[model samples]
Target: MHFEQQTPLNAFLNILFDRYQEKVPAVKKVTDALVAQGVVKSQQDIVNDHIAFRTLGVPHLGIQSFEKIFLHHGYQKRDYYYFEGKKLNAYWYAPPSDQYPRIFMSELMVSDLSEQAQKIIHRYTDPIQADPVNGLNFNDGLQIGEFFHRSLWPLPSKHDYELLLAESEYAAWVIYNRYYLNHYTISVHALKEGYNHIEQFDAFVEGLGIRLNTSGGKIKVSGDGLLKQSSTVAEMQEATFADGETMSIAGSYVEFAERLPLPEYADMPANQLTPAHRRNGFETNNADKIFESTYTGQTKA
Candidate 1:
């Protein structure tokens, strides 16, 4: 399910509420007034405690681009999570203190390829049919997007790992026409050993016939605030497509956010009745005390 236009960040929460009116009646009253239209059908399990929605596979223009778009619609970035366990990215959004249920986006993954795979990618390069609207090539028989994330996660063994890595370049060529940007990042563990540093990332992307667009910083950033100035000779590669689209992605990195505890106290408040009620018609706090005390050979204290 894809939204035709950019979803206003403010109204997204209301949209979520309306989708579950029967279960969460508290929201229908508020969501009814908002005229924000729906572009996709409610296509997930709607239950008492949770809801899920399918996301459109469109690349955001940039981080600042999303911030400006969402902020205007009354949404502030509440929290974000990068699930290293799943190799996925996610974020949470609050509805400006005016909406209910809030909104969350997750299961984000990125990809990069190996040199042997780059040769295979050259065979499927078709820049002419790439749809600028979605930044994807409008071609059939490619069946490539299915394979993009296949290699993103680490495989069972290094042999299988290299096998998937070898195929990613061709997969990119087919999927590249359908999506404007490809997400690339080395694992946190990999970076610790000075492996596949960002400079190498720049050169590797160019080899697949794309240009590194570093201005957005969407593809490259050190999770730590380390600044390094280097004149070390950097390897160069080219990322040009058949239709003259050239880009080399560099410096965009992802960091997972820490988790926090739930507000259990707010959900269940404390009782305030004091000892003064003991003398009146107040009952004991024990449910069994009033039942069969004689049969059990026990007396209330």
Candidate 2:
């Protein structure tokens, strides 16, 4: 269901989360486990730190085009991040108000890829001569939700996918999953007693049989130690390719983040703190590893 004109921001976000949960089994599984452990009374009590999206650096799309939806909904561009190893550029947007989650959008530098990889990507995207976002009904929440789940290009052949995977797993993921929700992070610090930190929550999740992404260690902490993050390895789903072949591939997963209160606010009572009182932006070092949640090496059974 889409959000109506009078829908509050919290209600609109609830709709998005419901849609995401329906498509991403990992989200529900994790949420259910948290509830069972008494970390949260229900899924609604789990504060979302942020949600991320992956896009291509093609002509019509990219962060430039995709960000309009959130911008129209009151988000403002904030910090810019660069991932040299992955050839990616990203930005984290601040929500209009504290009640909303932050946004992280990343785009692949297709030109940075090898010629063979670029050609394969262009084969599907080259057809669209104009920016697709121009046609979106930004005021219609339902339309925007569908846009997030819609496929912008045809499926790639398994061979082409493998080629892209060899060079950049990020490229392979965006090419096939196009516009799919990458992951939604739970604000672990906001949880009830015993599970308010990443260490505690990570162990609790693992106890429920969830495998986490361990590329840069299971828990990626910021240099300042104010932001800690962890994510489950993506669950595999069968994806049908252009060649009529189907294979199990990694889909979306869930993430947990514990944004510590700044040193100045460490002694303040919880009621005195606000969104700004905590670590408010993302950490590149931590995010770089979080992106590997969908890599074949990490997702393969």
Query: Pick by TM-score: which candidate is best?
Result: 2
Backbone clashes, each candidate:
23, 0
What is residue 209's positional error in candidate 2, in angstroms?
0.5
TM-score of 1: 0.26
Local accuracy by lDDT, each model? 0.26, 0.85
- Per-residue lDDT of model 2, residues 11-104, tens digit only: 4465667766777787878878877777677776778889999989999989999898889889999999999999999999998876668999
TM-score of each: 0.26, 0.94
Q: In model 2, what are the clashing residue pairs, if there are any? A: none
Error of 2 at 7 (Å): 2.6
lDDT of 2 at 172: 87
